[model samples]
Target: MAEERTESKTTILIVDDSEINRDVLKEIFKDDYTILEADNGKAAIDMVVKSRAFLAAILLDINMPEMDGFAVLTEIGKVKLLDKIPVIMITSDTSAETERRCYEQGVADVICKPFEPLIVKQKVSRSIELILSKRHLEEQITSQTKLLRAQYQQLQKQQEILKKNNALIVEKICTIVEFRNLESGYHLRRIHDFVSILGRYIMNMYPEYGLTQYQVDVMADASAMHDIGKITVPDTILLKPGRLTRDEFEVMKSHTTRGCDIIRMLSDIQDKDYFEYSYDICRHHHEKYDGNGYPDGLKGEDISIAAQLTGLADVYDALISERVYKAAYSMDKAFGMIVNGECGVFNPKLINCFRQAKLEMNNAFLKTKMKEKEELKALHGEDDDYDDD
Candidate 1:
């Protein structure tokens, strides 16, 4: 249908030894198509394979020197191009075995010799039309493949931009959380480094989380904002050296809602999903197994998976790090308490993975702490900035 608009003409290849038959056939199709002639089977094969465009149907003659129609069909079968180009066997001897062999070798249609000029034209036209339709489908497939590839590349670049941009925002937010407690950047930095180590440990064990190197990089950068909710906690409660009183603790629990609100607002403006992702992790990371968490008491499986994972990192660091009121527990004691204290609280599957790869997790934890110390020293090399109250 589309061919009617352009210099769109199908090509008919006539393979015969006799020049008379070739000219006669050429004359038959001259008005409707652009005719191409091949005196031998090899030439027809070369023209079909090397040239770009569809060969409607090959009118292959049985009687020819060197390579006959059968040989050409066989050659085409050998190369697996029979599906693209339909072969119509033109033979004088309508032998049973020859016809069977052509069909066995995967031919489209077979025509007997002493050919009727009108019938020859009709058969060739029909076969060509079918073959050309198939070729058009292939062209469409190639076009779609190229389009999908381009879209995939563009999406990948945009995700990179989102990953880095979100990290900067999370860092800024976590600094706000850190200032609420100690006014130093240490708490945010330490938690992020600890979570990075935990993430790597989990990735090594369970790759189903899509925790590839690139993904972990994104997770680590985003991890800094895990406690961003603490920013909304009142200064009296946040800065209280003593344990939070009952009423003060209730107010403290509202920080998660306030954090979610702020991030949700930012997500609305950015038209992005990364902040929402961090939002879930930040808001629900405190949830326990039996629905004891404040803000939204989502228990166990009800909690976001990202938040559950962040909880592991946050609690692990809290147990190990030296605090103002309580001394840090030893790693062995801390691990035992984490595993036994809450049932169905920490993801059992995650706990199992951590238990199995305990040594690796320990090594990662130590390495992360060391790395953070080095980084902190490099950032502030004994600067004389001190809190003189």
Candidate 2:
């Protein structure tokens, strides 16, 4: 009984100027539908706009006073309710042109006046079904689009988490290598900053290096792994106070290849650019531009620019910093050695960039030198009278 009452209360609108015509249609539908009536086209348009949520269909009279059925349809078009509400033209005028005009104005069907109640009921029922189905599909598409956007955002967060974890692992590897070399840990920091500074300068002066700012930053972090092979050398050779014996030097050189092998052991080390940069730097930082270096002896442009950058950074730090066997060279002397090719052959363009940046590099290193002195003093249990570089 409740379901039947709900079906009977479904709304339908009847529009006509003549009282008798409106009454006749209302009589036909009042039993099955709740009928709302408007005496003129203007009033019908207002009713449709106000009650469109519950209004199922419109039965419109073509010939009316003031605003006519066509004018009412133009109003419906303005509200964009043509797809959501079905409109059926009900009129006495049966001329073909009159029917054609109704159809042109987006009427769903045109029925001559004195139309059978059965035909009117069936047409309105079918139109409402089609409009409801379309609205349901549109709702489903909107829901799915929102879900897809949420999933894409979640995926981006996961990728960011993975990148941060990779960076942490890179730092761990750098610390392990520094501990093995008995380095003050400042070596890693200086090399990272030096490589980053030089990389940015090179990118600007030589775009052919094909480096983005992001790549330069990543290379700076990866540079810490360049000397990772030193971990494999015997402590006696690594900490030797004098020049290595020829045989000891040969064994020490193997650190380059051994570092690369260590990196290869990480199963999760995919062929990403940072990992590739670390591998090349670990194996080839010793290679000279003239092909006179150890291990694979990569020469000229054959060497990756990443390896070349780390090599120069490593050598510059080595020359200007004190080692157990040698006093720190003065800044002027260190500069002279590189320019004179006393350190090893390098890419000429890189050398030119160094020339331009040498003053700034020296100033930056002065700060690092002071910090290193403090650390060294603490390690040696010495007084502040330690000589400044």
Candidate 3:
């Protein structure tokens, strides 16, 4: 028994109005526990608050001078220390109503004043064990909760890192395709910028697309790979100075499926949004809204929205760009051709957004022209004969 008391080092608080009752209880438990005595409820509350970390149980009396047992329980409840310390009610009254009130006030057990010494010790020991067990369980739950939260945050950070890396790899791969197709890197930049603008407008005006901001961002960047497969086309056809023959056009169209296959080889891209947007734009950017597109005649909404945004961006750039087959059309003519359906059918909703976004598009074009002039002036000196064409 002495060894057992030493192992646990239990502490007990006895609150009572009578010095005799306090003395009796202390005498009973003094051998087995570190006993704390309080003459009134206020003193007991103070003791419980001060020693809450070590105190195992509280022995409270129902009748006291200023604050009663119920009032003390209320005070303990205010500090939320009731569960940490098991309360046992000790009083002279043995009425059922009084016992019920004590139990309702969250006491561990109620004992009449003519209590047996052995019974008091047994009850207090059991209550102390119960409180200790509850505190142990609560501590375990708090520890586990903290651990899970940390793991979740770590997982989120790792996923974000992977996404950023995949995007960089895609951009680099697209740069290689630009070189192989004999186009400047500016083509990729302009396509990405144009599609981003269209995607933002569509997300704001069309709720049916269910497009999230993350999806929009991925789609914009993924558009850079729309011509990744043009790297596979023969130089004779890819660099043709005139319109392609029917056979040559057919060969050129195969780039769509070829680009998809090439993107699939990149095993590092694990994000579903990135993969889906990249694959869809690469394979279906040439698809028409009227189901007359090649490789697969997916019409209207059947073609992924990602493809639609990228396709329009491609068409706009190709019109304004001086390709081997044609001189650059003026901006007004290109806009008229797209809006008048000369550039194949397009989604009506996107068509409206295209109209609204044209002003911004022109502004971006002017900025590029200004940057080009700056570069030219740096190369040829500011006073050199410079043509604005």
Q: Which stretches of candidate 3 lie over 4 Å from their true place?
A: 1-12, 18-37, 57-62, 69-83, 86-145, 181-184, 269-272, 330-332, 368-388
Total clashing pairs for each candidate: 2, 0, 0
Worst 10 residues of 1 by lDDT: 2-11
* lDDT of each residue in 187-206, candidate 3, tens digit only: 67778888888999999999
lDDT of 1 by residue, 101-165 (tens): 87887877777767788888788777777777887998999999999999999999987776667
Can you list the residue pairs that collide in candidate 1?
Answer: 56-128, 289-345
Q: How close is candidate 2 to the true structure, as a TM-score?
A: 0.62
lDDT score of model 1?
0.70
Kindly provide the TM-score of model 3 when superposed on the true structure, using C-alpha atoms.
0.75
As a whole number from 0 to 100, the lDDT of residue 141 in candidate 1 is 93
Candidate 2, which segments miss by more than 4 Å at Cα? 1-160, 269-273, 374-389
Q: In candidate 2, where is summed lDDT lowest over 10 consecutive residues? A: 266-275
lDDT of the candidates, in the order given: 0.70, 0.83, 0.85
Task: Indicate the residue-level lDDT of 59 in model 2.
Answer: 88
Q: Which ten residues in a row have the lowest lDDT in candidate 3?
A: 177-186
How does each model score on TM-score?
Answer: 0.78, 0.62, 0.75
Query: Which of the predicted structures, 1 or 2, would earn the higher TM-score when compared with the native?
Result: 1
Task: Report each candidate's C-alpha RMSD, comma-separated, in the order given.
Answer: 5.1, 7.2, 5.0
